[model samples]
Target: MASTDNALKTASVLAFERKLDPSDGLFHAGNWDGRDDTTAWKPVTLREKSVRGTISNRLKTKDQDPAKLDAAIENPNLQTVDVATLPADADTLRVGFTLRILGGTGRPSACNNAAYQTKLLSTVQGYVDANGFGELGRRYAHNLANARFLWRNRIGAEQVEVRIQHLEKGQPKTSWTFDALQLSLRDFQTPNGVEKDINSLADVITTGLAGKGHVLLQVTAFARIGAGQEVYPSQELILDKATSKKSKTLYDVQGIAGIHSQKLGNALRTIDTWHSEADTLGPIAVEPYGSVTTLGKACRKPTDKLDFYNLLDGWLLKDKAPPPDQQHFVMAILVRGGVFGEAGKD
Candidate 1:
């Protein structure tokens, strides 16, 4: 139990407005430069195939015919298709969102909670001044530049392209293409090595944070699910309603896959929640007499309550606060987790 006196009482949410249109784009990977190509947005279709099994003692016990089994085996069996390519005319998804510090500069009322405001305000402002929302920018850039927004990216997606149109004073419309599988977290670094695209994205975010403009980002994703030699789990594995056994159909076995626009919208919501690394401190339990520690070593007693700002303050004091990117990532997640409002009070 952690003490409530030092708890975090306020936070800001970085919500984005989003839209998905599956039918808008030519569905293919190779036509990225606005060229007409046949490979773009190709639909994946699955054809049913027969299953072959060998006759055995179990079949004999069931009075199954071995001759029929042999005949079935002799016929040409359909090859298994584990993944599918998405067809053109598939709905293309579009997400519209902005990133900004909710309570900074012109939005003092954003952090209206009286208890923690005085203490945390200066720190937050200092962070804004130095980092210019770099952490939030970096994460957003990574999500787009890496195609982390593509649900099928976990499978095999050749390309994930993001076309950005910024409505700002000095910036022009820009677009970037990324190899979905090749983008990594390290690409968001300040110097960012040879990846000029990521660096440009970082600059865009910095401009947004500086109040120069808002970003309009449209993402187009193209993926091939079941084409290669690898076998993947079919989408049709379900419990049989009649037999209550695991069942599948040939339709489930093979085909191309495309993500729905609504699903793409939902994926973007993931940024709202924070995911922190596991706590290094061992667990602490409180008993009627005293405290028990997971390590079985001498330790301080547990507090009654705990929250993000408290931990952040402690870390800042100890010079152990995470880097700006990590901090922004955690904050976004915390906002999505609903850890703000009066309930966040210490």
Candidate 2:
């Protein structure tokens, strides 16, 4: 029975806390053979360098004349940028970080309407009771095993290996190693050779999400890109365009080049094949609006009623549930967590 005060009314204040948390990945350099003993690896550091770049962008109509273009190329653009590369003696890059899988999915951090909140939790519980988080867990585990979080660093590597360690009280309970290149980034398919390891890792993550206290994991990935190859680190977004002299600023933590936790989270949640364009566009990071910033357009629009808010409201208020895939998408948004309260108008 719906409460009289809250029946058919959306909560004005609702929010869920993110469940999967990861620390910033720190970069280190070492010989590929020395990967077994990462204790001897050296911290990768950032250096500021100046490079002369030719003006190659399309010129304005007035400046397109041959004489004008030739003169422009002579005065090359000098760019001061930050760069990180493996030391001459090191042929591999080591990135390491810790991940914490939290519980209490679908439980809002804040909600004023108890009735609405109760229904939401019930809905989430129903999904867990039925699905067991296997699909979601498998995709996340796939991302980790494939080293997708390495982004550009994983590209063009001669070889890549990823190691995941389940931690208990600062000690490893179990560990798994992956030959990352064999795993495809375009899909979450666990190859026959590595299915056992992938499933084991997924089981741990799904268990944590099922409210089994919490789970901690230590992750390390090695990319053998050859000695002195330039490594890519997360670039800091500069808001003050005029004040900064450098066009690019690489992220660092206390002088150690690193990747942001947000970036890692994005990579982990790239499991949304349920979107409308799954036929063409492939997976994107789970989002309420199905937004891919790089594409500059939304895939799950309200017009289609496939977005988070529409599906959630219909499911909760109208007794209308979305399709199975959409139901999974809704649950993923709840797992990602955000302020989803409806706004009031005067």
Candidate 3:
């Protein structure tokens, strides 16, 4: 490596905003047949339920004695929790959100080092020219069409349908409907019949990333489970668990049960099959460290030179182009976006 190149350092004020912006998913309940007419659907509301409960949790040795166990069982563990359920007449759960795919991906939101930023942007442009955004765009579109953003709500659904509309102003310009259950979460293979539609959707996303045009999409997913069945919404992270009155707090937007945009984004970007453990673990979300918080382990690590910093620096600073997969990983980190500046030295 050249001395000049070795001397170059990462920007101390580097940051990037997420290119794929999504709004919070608002939940609604309606009959499966009424999916075409969502105007009549009702917003899923939270209901408070109290349960007598039982003492099933692990107890200390002292509390395991026969008399003590009997006494504890008598008291039991009573609690009040918030739950969301589809109305008895409504057999479908509708999740709606708008996604805006912004351009200027490679450009940093903040970068102090002009020289380094220039090289980085140039490298990203080179990638765009050679590969285009087709691969990543296709995967993202697939996630949408598959209704992966529905998360737990899609599980055991009798039928899942996804409708995506290209919005111009307040109206839809073009629309696509998908039988979400036909798509697989494990791979990005074009499902036999939906190939053309997936490709069309992928092209729009690619165009958005390439700065060809602005892309705004309205997405609606219908999951037909059963009437009066429990529907899963995003849970609020209670910082003070002990002091909190309700054990389970469902997320709400003005009294209407909803899912977090972060959770939806996480589901959509679960396209990191480039990591080493992907074959076994399936596709985790595209994160800088390839982190899957639910799994409690990072798929990529700096020690292994598989992390974003290592691969990115190798490409831009070291003048060593990474493999296509690794390149995709680096670009994905940019799409995910973060404040990635190197910390200042003392």
RMSD of every candidate to native, in Å, equals 11.4, 2.5, 2.0
The all-Cα superposition gives candidate 2 an RMSD in Å to the true structure of: 2.5
TM-score for each model: 0.47, 0.94, 0.95
lDDT of candidate 1 over 1-346, digit per residue (tens)? 3447776544343122111112212223222343224344343344444445443333232565888866755665333323433334342322223323222222233455554555454555565667665555555566555555454344443344454444345454776665555665333332344267766776776565455655444455543332332222224434654743322332221233334443333344333222221133321211111122334642222242123444454543343565554455434433233223334336
lDDT of 2 by residue, 1-346 (tens): 3567546677999999998899999999998898888587999999999999988777675747888777977788889999999999999999999999988888999999998888887888888888878888888899999999999999999999999999999999989999999998887777889999999999999988888856999999999999999999999999997999998999999999999999999998999999989878888999999999999989989999888999999899988878888888888888788899999899
What C-alpha lDDT do the candidate models reach, one value each?
0.41, 0.91, 0.92
- Give the number of colliding residue pairs in candidate 2: 0
Segments in model 1 whose C-alpha atoms lie over 4 Å from true places:
1-112, 158-172, 185-194, 224-309, 312-339, 342-346
Error of 3 at 2 (Å): 6.2
Considering summed lDDT, which 10 consecutive residues are worst modelled in model 1? 282-291
* Candidate scoring better on lDDT of 1 and 3: 3
Candidate 3 has an lDDT of 0.92
